[model samples]
Target chain A: MDKNLWRWIELNEYETPSVPTTMLAKRWWQKMLQTLRPSRVEVSTANSAEEEPKGVEFKFDEQPLLDSLNTLLDQQNQDDPRVTWLVLAPASPAWSVIRKWANQNGWQPVSMPQRDSLLTSSSVDELNIPSEPWVVDDLSHGFVRHPLGIRWLQNFLRKTLQTPQSPGLVICGSWLYYYLEKTHGGLNRQALTLRPFDTESMVTSRIAVSRAHAKRLVAVSEGHPGIAAAYRNAFAVAAEQTEIVLEMPQVPTAHGETSTFVIYALLLHGGLSTFLLGEVLNSIAPNLIEHSLNLLRSHGIVRYQDDQWSVTELGYPAAKQFLAQRDFNWTSC
Target chain B: MDTQKISDLFKTVDSNAALQVVTIILIAWLIVFLSQRLLPRLANLLHSKQRLYTLALIPLIRLVVVIVALVMLVPIFIEPTLKNMVAALGALGLAIGFAIKDYVSSLIAGVVAIHEMPYRPGDWVTIDGVYGEVTHIGLRTVELVTPDDTVVAMPHEKIWQHAVLNANNGGPSLMCVAEFFLTPESDGLVVKEALEQIALTSPYLQIHKPVVVTVNDEPWGTRYRLKAYPVDPRQQFKFITDLSLRGKQRLLDLKIEFAKVETAKVN
Candidate 1:
């Protein structure tokens, strides 16, 4: 029923929603006022989920996402041996819709190999390439930030682009896509992503939110549906209408460099286990890393779930704002 | 010139003009003080490019405010004539040149520094063998906060004789070099490749920039320089530390031996 709700486009074509000049001025004034007059530390509670709307609910429909995937497959030129479909999935919505679609369509899914095997593997045969179309669920998991850990990613990219292989789809996290675009530029040219939900789209959609609230949501979340949904849950619904709450967190405050980098690394990798996170930030002391993670966890900026620690969907908007303010490299979306 | 003509150079110094001068001074000082205090805070909140641009604006803003105050105040004190102005400046120069030649030179050099931009507020620079971040560019001296957090004030006149080595100039990309001296028995190619990886794998590295490893033959050992850039100039020290620590670890993992240098110990 939600078919064609979002159009799929090349990753390079995606854009963050533009903020209105008035809103930007208001935010700038707020920051200036805060600087001029110091205030008490803002505390955010993790139990805000209890404030969910009473009677109004919108369940996500998988039909549109599946149709978008079908369109991507149909658009691929089967005759061109050099072509490989690359998808950059956003960090929110823990599950992969593409993987589910692949399974439903009988397409095989490939999991990342162990980090050690990457260094020892010699050829493309190590991938055990299926004779049919395949989907690599999360390319972000293929490599570590360490020297020896990146070989698998290098080898996999070479196999996919250099040699003739089966038609395949590789899904990478948005942050990983940004990283790889800088590290490996050529693959960036062929990557695809789902279109962002701008103010117009949200207002026209089936969601019960008012137009004013939709604009604020788009402005804060930068058109990422998952992040928008996270913030949307904070809204109070009355007679099928969503009311905006002023208490929703605006931007997260990262106290120091350690906390900032921890948030950045988690976003870049989508999520990483505690051990892998430690390995990625080996320069930082173990105790400091644990402290920063705990601090961010309390702020709702990050959370540990499903064996991996990641920036929470609710905190993503604020975390992104924090990172952007500090001039950290970020995904375009 | 007659006494009447000499006195013509002076515009009437009424209470109104005095009040106007005070107002101008107060406003100008307020602007400069607030800008000096606030811009750095704002810059710290921003990312690389915006931060540098905001910081570099501080000196330029100060310069403009001072010049504007001078322009507004000069007319209140002197008659508007080429001859009067020249005669006034000549006498002032004579007294100032004799009394504070070094101070005046530093001031003029500060203006030139602003124009040449040898270093900006955020730039990491080494001047006259004193290395530090260019924290503030004052009228007579440039302030630097050294690596040890000591503030050093070097007169702007140093631009006349000393070489100003700017690491990042006014940009965020500062190249950090980690040097390694290995015994001649170690393989140069292997060390080179390993050093490259060490720099590449550094979390502090600016991935867009190229990571380079240069090898040289020294009498004591084979020297390797692994060079890369950090995302921010402020991260240069951390970047170098990470590179050095990890490079040594990786080299030792390869069983490479370090060249021992013997030097006399000083008390």
Candidate 2:
């Protein structure tokens, strides 16, 4: 057996060879076999009695969130049954956790169809959505706005609001949340934002770990469960190899005069023309702005396209953190 | 000093001592040359607000190296004894001091300039009537590159006679003013708010810094000046340009007109 397979089997407490396998373990075995065979390996499609569901298991603490959501739903059930509950969160482990929680609570979890699927259907009736209270997962994948998706959402909201005894709805994901928030004005009070675990919660959740290490994880991952889990896994493997703890990564400060200006400008304007940026930094010569932008580009912090300069995904967090440290709100910008 | 002692001081310069002195001079020159060539490139490559501070160190570093070289060469060119060196330096100083009074004064002023630091290599300054960015702070003269790309070498002796107006001092940020002339009949409140917004919305405006709008009623028109700081001193002109162009457009949008210009009478 491969070392990884052995470790997985041991970790999951499986019998050596004859134990009933889960869907995850069976899939892993199939992947290993395919890699080993390299030529004409047929994957068996037989269903097993002991197969587990094909969904990720979220291990983060979500009881408080569940309790809060239940309270909101109970209140709505009494007062306004037609209002749809908007559970706004970044698309990650939080979305998955909310979906799983809804499923466990007897609320039917419904995954949104892809953008292409929605586009192909002419009427909302053709899609055949369930009338029962449903939790919509992956509401906006890839953060790209689709007009059809917006139309479908608007239609659904209208139908739900028109019905006297409507099933309470739960919508998840950031881009969709932003779109709804902007276009649909009355949903703000009904929205429940799901945030990641705080520093104290993160520290207490782990067993036999130092508070310093837990704080390091929170700082590095920005309290995102998926990122924290990934870092933990990497740290475990590295610790096994080196038998030493890794030094914490140093966070970059936004104290640099020009850097602060560039980041602030990009955040406020979303993007800026080269000429306008040069004008904004008027004391700097045109050549210096080009040189500074080139350096920022090389660092993967800033990107230039169509004569406009903007911050990249990698740069956004650093910029946000930098601003936050200085008591400046990136959202306000 | 006696003639015999003066002759003896000259005779003390042996081949070995001469070689040491030459070697020190060469090393100092190389240090200066390489630093001059490399530091600016490094600073530019780094591309941060720290670039100005980094570039400023080059002149100071060169000065230190030269001073060290001269100190090392002093003993090699003459006798190593303190009494002999002091006597020789005193005699040489008297002759050079009288012969090159202005040069010596400037040299002493250069030392004071380094200590006082009225301007650095990257600072924007105005000395006498010339305004420019200081490119090099040399021993006797400061090299400034003007907005028109003219490099002027102004001697340090002028520091005694004239004030050096440093825009940014040693920092990276500098304030710029954008002035607009509107008809006296225009609403001051509306124009003031609009000008304030222009500064606030400017891409180059330093948000942490204050933006001020002041108005003065002139005989010709109402003069409105928007004073704001750019993120960097180098962006002063551009910042002013952005404010001016935008402020004028805003005034035009609000239906405000400029004051009519009066022709000057030539004598």
Report lDDT (CA) for all predictions. Answer: 0.76, 0.59
The most accurate candidate by TM-score is 1
**Cα displacement (Å) at residue A277, model 2:** 12
Q: After superposing candidate 1, which stretches have Cα over 4 Å from the reference?
A: A1-3, A27-40, A45-57, A75-83, A91-95, A115-126, A203-205, A208-210, A238-243, A246-254, B1-23, B184-190, B260-267
TM-score for every candidate vs. truth? 0.88, 0.58
Question: Considering summed lDDT, which 10 consecutive residues are worst modelled in model 2 chain A?
Answer: A1-10
- Candidate topping DockQ: 1
What would the per-residue lDDT of candidate 2 be over residues B98-181, giving only the tens digit for each residue?
A: 898898888888888888999888889999999999988788899999999999999999999999999988876688999999
Candidate 1 on A1-333: residue-level lDDT in tens?
345566777777888778778777976776555434433345455434334544545555666766777786766555543434555545433246777877887767775786445444243225655656677878777777776666677777777765455567777787776777676655644676777777777765544377777777777677777767766655644434544543444333444578778888888777888988888889999898898787777666777888788887667766776667566775566
lDDT of 1: 0.76
TM-score of 2: 0.58
Runs of candidate 2 exceeding 4 Å displacement: A1-266, A269-315, A318-333, B47-49, B80-83, B264-267
* Chain A superposition TM-score per model: 0.85, 0.47
